[model samples]
Target: MKSNTPRMPGRPKRQDQDMPVQETVLFTASRLFMELGYEAVSLQQIAKACGVTKASIYYYFDGKPQLFTASVSAVLERARTSTSQILVQPLPLRERLIKVSEAKLARSHGDFETILREARSSLSQKQLDEITSKEEMIHDCLAEHLIKAMDAGEIRRTDPLLTAHAFSAVLMLGIREIAKGTPADKLARDIVDLFWDGLSIR
Candidate 1:
């Protein structure tokens, strides 16, 4: 006499139970690509790190090129989302700019750009265009906010696009300082102070 108990479809056996194999592969590949550069990392290494086989990674992404493209795109998408959120806040332009600057400074420590530069030749034209489109979206968001600020008399009147570019350049300087072991909070404050002082209406 055996008791019948419904065993709940014994939790499907995935490569990683906590996350989908495809997402795991993407995240693992992204980290490796950023840390080792595209040329240095192999699919085998990423698969091993993700507790799956090399074939598993290939199943999700066509190859190394696609994997790299997907990885960089993921990072850029996150940046775009973050910037968009900051832009939509009802705060003054200076406050929003500081927030955006702080967010960029924090994220700039990643080696996403290094991976892109190293893998440029391997990436397809379409992949390059996709990356460019995402980047342009971020810049456009910043420029839009700057234009609004100008119209509201919160900042000095200037070419919004040019001003946004200049602001980005200044924020990039903070990234350099961050790489040199400068505290991000301190650097962010200094950057915001310098940028706001220069752009603020007297």
Candidate 2:
């Protein structure tokens, strides 16, 4: 089995001296975006959640566009961290891939997924570009591991990027059903089984 190594991300952006305040705003925005949708979530509403004034939010971010982007990006970073931990373990390629999918499925239930579906209406072109790049980095990480496994013959040889996207798509679909009362463990296991068996078939 090919052992995959985790890639360390670039240096963290230094948090503002007022990081606690920015984090609170981000927290409030993330939850509200999930519940209310981005269009319905006003700066005043976010301020109310953070126990601050709308001006305070503006001091941290230009507007709702940046707020939503920062909030969802935080969640994606968390998911990326979880995936990094999963990849570092000495496991078979298939098992490592399954674990990565399950980690992402857990994250899918959070506010970011809702924000992702809704943020396009609220974010600016710059904000959209930044968030898209962050998400694309995560996809690239998965594709990298797949390529390594394929080269080592630990899994079927396939288009690495396409397989990575397919793996992500299946997990996202499974997570949507899992959110609606299908047990997460059962759904994850069944999805892994389907992927494994399908790969095994000629």
**How does each model score on lDDT?**
0.78, 0.72
- What digit string (tens of lDDT, one per residue) describes model 1 on residues 5-117? 65334222343387888788788887777667889999989988988777777667789999888886787788889999988998877677778878877763445455678
lDDT of 1: 0.78
* Model 1: lowest-lDDT 10 consecutive positions: 7-16
Winning model by lDDT: 1
Model 2 worst lDDT window (10 residues)? 6-15
How close to the true structure is residue 84 of candidate 2, measured as C-alpha lDDT? 72
Model 1: lDDT of residue 168: 75
Q: Rate residue 93 of model 2 by lDDT.
A: 70
- TM-scores, all models, native as reference: 0.83, 0.79
91: Cα error in model 2, Å = 1.3
